[model samples]
Target: MSAVPAGSPVRTGAVVPVLASAGITVALMQTLVIPVIPELPRLLNASAGATAWAITATLLAAAVATPIMGRLGDMYGKRRMLLISIGLLVAGSIVAALSSSLVPLIVGRALQGFAAGVIPLGISIMRDELPSDRLGTATAQMSASLGVGGALGLPAAALLAENISWHALFWVSAGLGVIILGLVLRFVPESSVRSGGRFDVLGGVGLSFGLISLLLAISQGADWGWTSAPTLGLFAVAVVTILAWGWWERRTSEPLVDLRTTARPQVLLTNLASMVFGFAMFAMSLVVPQLLQMPKATGFGLGQSMLASGLVMGPSGLVMLLTAPLSAKISAARGPKATLMLGAIVVAAGYGVGSILMGSVWEIVLVSLLIGAGIGLAYGAMPALIMSAVPVSETAAANSFNTLMRSIGTSVSSAVAGVILANLTINLGTHTLPSQTGFRTVLIIGAAAALVALAIAACIPTRSPTPTPPATPASAEAPATA
Candidate 1:
């Protein structure tokens, strides 16, 4: 395919803010329900496990939708797919807001998961449309927006939930979705790049089932005993289906994911690093709020309210937001590998600090700041690595794969952390704390995961050399004549 003319106008600058808004809307939807998780049981007459679906269902939906949407974007158009995703978000939020039962709420949240593709689509658009000089900063800002939205949305959602009602949070999200849709429709220019390929319907279906089976097994394993028949059956299905899906992708002409490109050392290693980073990053999201809000009556707990707890974690997102540009600079000066290693080391240090200091809200806040900075640096570097490694054509699919890895990492970490915390209970006479010992144990594990990612990042070779063009006799003769 021919490239756009060098002098032709591209509205990349105008597109950035609209994509950023979309990023924030998606991030907010993911975490806005967190502050309400504790109250859901009473409000909806549901059990803790059932209420937890509000969060997991969104995750599961995103896990399935991201890759599918990425492939669809490749097959159709990124801007078109993006608008469709935003429309889904608006509709989902409205449905969730109006729901009177957990079932409808889960369905709505699932639909919102389709919007997770917005970030990657935005990144791909930047690569295709932005000028070379501005590309680095634009990518960094877009990547940082993920954490920014999450951090900014947490406190906002907390306050809204505290002042109004839980449903109000969804209503606010619906409003933001509409505004983002308007911005995108008006400002984001349509891509001239179009995929002439056909969609892999069968591959998409198989992959979806494979992912759902695996995620459901992992997420529900603790609730159902690990050795139970249902768990074992799901695990078996996941293994067989994923293997089959892999085989199918390899044979098909236009695979849902380009496995050959994805298997490149740089791409593979970057994705592995993403998994470890995702695991460590999400552990904080799970542990910090719970640690802060646990009653002080239980020796090791601070016992802050839900709103206050969300606020404590909220600043970490802000720190991440502030550091994204700095991270881009670091990557520019050194390389994405160096930046990733530095970020991982910082994350390891943050978790190590958390393991030692868990008594006060301020202490947790300080640790969060460190972790947030680490995430900013690491998250910003990932797309740079992926984009650099893959051809421009594969950008969206490659990114979605990386995103999927991160989500899987988070899901695994959530399950593992849940088990550890569940097993370790601190007795406070009348009540119990979340085994301070257990929390410490999990933090140590998180720190260790970061160190492992740091090692992987360190091992990746410096930039691969660009191929040299062969000299032609005509060119050589011209040079001699000159």
Candidate 2:
């Protein structure tokens, strides 16, 4: 593949589409079950709390698996790890398709989530393979794939669940995975750029435990009660574990994450912006659906069905698809930092306008579209910014860490939004639902988070000229290549 030379379009364009498709497949898993969540208990003969594990399992698995797989890709071949991730998705989907009980379903779901490393892996592959001129557009599209798959998947899953056996959902997911796997094998080239290392076994275990504890507490704290012992205990353990992990990473010869490079202001600030942007993007997703489906009798609600609400939000994904290339263009001319700041402002404006426009379905749809466009712009810039600062050998690990930050942001948004909607509700006779004020509060929070990202983006110094020297393999077992 390196035969295409540095600027060859054929070499650059050939890999991006398949890699992006793989990315979309990974993101689709996040929303595949949303339409069936309410019916899970009745369908599986389980309690609501027990059924909730299907979602939680995926979240936990993704948080732990993303960075680990990224590190593995750096040590191994990027294409090899990418294919492995896709294989896990297919296997998990097939297992879920065959399951009737909650245990098997949760197990399969977690397995599916284990494939969450694909997005970062794809981004890293692009960095290694694509020409610098093509890199921005290609990476941006890869980043937008996360939202595109999610937005498109919701309505598709809803339609499938409503029209056919719910098992069809998993089967279809499996089919998509298989198709993607084949496409990846046929078109995507294996990246030669390797950041080979002695995989830090203890550090990996510590980081995984730390992430699980922290994310679990954040995700479940609202359900378990914020002040509960289990929640507090998990939070405390997470802090200590994470601190220890950092200490170990700093000392280890072949660290899982390059703490020194990550400490640079550019990478640090870019990751910070990604987290806040993730938070801001999720706010629209959480609020718009609730606002649309709530009864119009509540005066603020649009009273749409779940399917209708999904349809209303589906167009946003298309907006993201269209905006990604434009974002890349802006980044090429003005720098990714400028693009990121622009995206932040646009997102903040989306929320500000959306708060006032909640009276109609079109208005809400417009808001989702606006937010999606901003997300596309910001998301596209992130990989470009990260790849610019990190070494070729550490590309996958750095990208994976950025993806993890986004996940952290989304998890916090879910917990925070859940709390606001829960407490700030209106009682209507025998029924209680989140008040319009609660929805407004969440939108405002989204705007504030975007503005915070904007400020952080401003702090990222304009793109630097410093270059990473080629690697002398990380260890005796590692490859000696870029």
Candidate 3:
């Protein structure tokens, strides 16, 4: 294996496509169920709050799984872990499809959520398999696709659900999962790099509990009064557990996360920016559909159907797909920091535009395009920044950490948006707009978050060099021969 040069074309042909498809699969599973949320009350004979758990359950599962799986991949093998995650998605889809009750559906969604690990795994694999010259573009494209998949999946799922049954969405996802599994088996080569350490079962358990406790509190706090014992106790446990987990990681020989490298200013700031961008981007995903599909009698709404509302968000994903390569080019020229700053400024501007003009469906769509472009630019830069700062050995872990941060941002934002929309009321005589005031408040929050990210980007020292190529074993051996 050492005889093969790192940049040798042998691996690129097989690896790149597989990694890209893996990313698409991740997005498909994550977003496919979103369109079904509004319909869940009728489908499962549940209340509105209970139905929302389908989305929340998936988020919770993915948040906990991403970092653990990334660490596992680093310790064992990326290809093996990728296969495991895809398999889990398939099983989850099947379970979801077969379910007649909300419990089964939530279980299935939780299972499928594990697939979120695929993004960080693919990004890490790209770092490992691709040459330095090619790495930037490949990672950028993969990172951008997360937004693209989300953008595209909403319409695809909405159209399917509207035309057929909601169960069809899961059926379609299962079919896609099978295809992704085959692709991985055929094209993705196993990594030779392995860490000879046992899995830290205790540490993983502690981390999972900590995250679950924290997320549970944040997500449920609005429904259950913040003063409630369950909410307060969960928050307290989360703080203590997370602190304990950090100490354990510092001492463990095979820690679940490498805290030292993650603590670096570059990696730390990049992750923070990712969280903010994630929060800002999710505002569109959460609010736009509500604004569009809401009954016109509600005064502030356009009364678009679910399918049409989803279609509005689809173009943003398309824009993200188109803008990714451009983002890579900008990062290559002006550096990732500049690209991130530019993206944040664009996001803030997009929200500002949204605040003024979101009364119509087309205006919402137009703002989505701007938001998608901003996400494409900013999301692409985050992984590049992280990969640059950490050792190759730490790529998966670092990327996973960054991915986790984005999830955190999205979860926090989703909960906050829920609160804002719930508290504000709009009354327009015969018809009351659900609450234009709430929408405005969330948009303002998003705009401010984007500005904070921009400020952080400015603070990131521009002196750090672009990532350099790793020396292949072949190159090292060549010197001996000479």
Candidate 4:
């Protein structure tokens, strides 16, 4: 592999936008079915628990495939893997659009999940192609696309669900996928850098099993009875499998994850903080919409429709988009560590304010904007932090692993929030709803998570960690100068 010639043109102007659009498209899939989740059981003629698999399948598949696809992106070609990912998204959307029942929908969703690598891969591509000065903001925007798409997609999805068949949602997803795929092919360039190596088939299998078992336990624990044999058994299997996987990863010459690189204090602490930030970030998503849509009769409920709630939440994503560049500027001047800390502090403050000011729609909107800004800032800094500490060859895999940590955190937050809300419910006439106390408690916990992330970010070294030697590429000699 060789670098592009010094005089060769790089169409960076086109690359960043295309990659970012690719990222936003993949993210839309995550929220595409959210508006239809409650109606799923009736629509699909399946039990509620069975229909829930529509969501779980995507989670499990994303968790399992993100890292593996990322590794392939590094080894083969980032652009190549990215195209394959979008292709899967298109295929999944079409399959889902055609499905009238549970099984195919779940399968389609799992395939959509396989595209979760797109964002990290896009970040990696930006690193490989963008000018150094352009890299931070480009990656920041790409990172924020997750929230941007989720926030923006909700109202559109709600509208579609209200006026159009639910299947229309998948059709739209497929249509967008096709457009993004064409744009990527036309504008994005395959990187010359490659970490050529045989795929770690065994490690991938082990990690997949471990993640699936762990997430299944966490996601289903409440319904399964937290202490039930199935939940405990899955937890046990997860712990053992992850431990064995770690052992094997440490020993394998060509590993699925380079543990040595991952264990560096900078990388380790960033991942820990990412998980905590993820918990804090998701806490808002869980609390706000419910607060907005709750019946006004409960004394606290706002009684808004799903579309109204989504519209109210829409500005938060806009704030995130607007804040991404500022985050990059902060990272440039003060360091990514400072940006991360600032973001955490803002998040904590947002939740703290949310706890006190839950009385009106305006107050909730303010809270959403504050937290969205915080998440944008934090998310922008993460790739810089990871890239600074990792070898160029390992960029996608390392970033993918960080993304996985965040996903894990959100999963745990969802489970914990569900338990808190389920156990602390108030009866409104004939309906049971999460009590104001439960929502308050979740907000408090969200603030606590932000504070924890802040503390963890504080522990990160003031200086970048000394990077380990770049791994030997299986197909080519090491670069003469790095």
Judge candidate 4 against the unseen true structure and give its global Cα lDDT, from 0 to 1.
Answer: 0.88
Please list all clashing residue pairs in model 1, or write none if there are none: none
Error of 2 at 132 (Å): 1.9
Provide the lowest-lDDT 10-residue window in model 3: 473-482
Clashing pairs in 4: none
Which has the better TM-score: candidate 1, or candidate 4?
A: 4
Question: TM-score, each model?
Answer: 0.93, 0.94, 0.93, 0.95
Clashes of each: 0, 0, 1, 0
Q: Please write out the lDDT profile of model 1 over residues 1-482, one tens digit for every residue.
A: 23233234666667777787787778887788987888898988889999889988888889888898887775676777888899999889998999888888888898888788888888777766676656666677777777778777777888998899989998989999888888777777656554548888889999999999999999999999889999999999999999999999999998999788888788889999999888988888878888887877777788898778878888888788778777778888887788889999999999999999998988999999999999999988888888777766666777888888988988899999989998898777776567888889999999999999998887776772221111222331121110
Query: For residues 275-367, what per-residue lDDT tens digits would candidate 4 score against the true structure?
Result: 999999999889998999999999999989988888888898889888999988998888889999999999999999999999999999999
> What C-alpha lDDT does candidate 2 achieve relative to the native structure?
0.88
lDDT of each: 0.81, 0.88, 0.82, 0.88
Task: Write one digit per residue (lDDT tens) for candidate 2, span 1-482.
Answer: 22222223334456888888899989999999988999999999999988999999999999999999999998988788888999999999999999999999999899999999999999987877665667778889999999998898888898999999779999999999998888777677676567565899998999999999999999889989999999999999999999999999999999988898889888999999999989999998899888989998998999998889899989998888889999988988888899999999999999999988999988998899899999999998898888777777878889999999999999999999999999999987899999999999999999999999999999998873222222233431332121
Clashing pairs in 3: 298-432
Backbone clash total for model 3 is 1
Model 1 / residue 247 / CA error / Å? 0.3
Off by over 4 Å in 3: 1-14, 427-433, 463-465, 470-482
Q: Write the per-residue lDDT of candidate 3 for residues 307-365, one digit (tens) a residue.
A: 78878988898788678777878888888899899999999999989988878877898
After TM-score superposition, the amount by which residue 480's alpha carbon in candidate 2 deviates from its true location, in angstroms, is 17
Using TM-score as the measure, the top candidate is 4
Query: Top model by lDDT, which number?
Result: 4
RMSD for all candidates, in order, please: 5.5, 3.5, 3.9, 3.3
lDDT (C-alpha) at residue 326 in model 3: 79
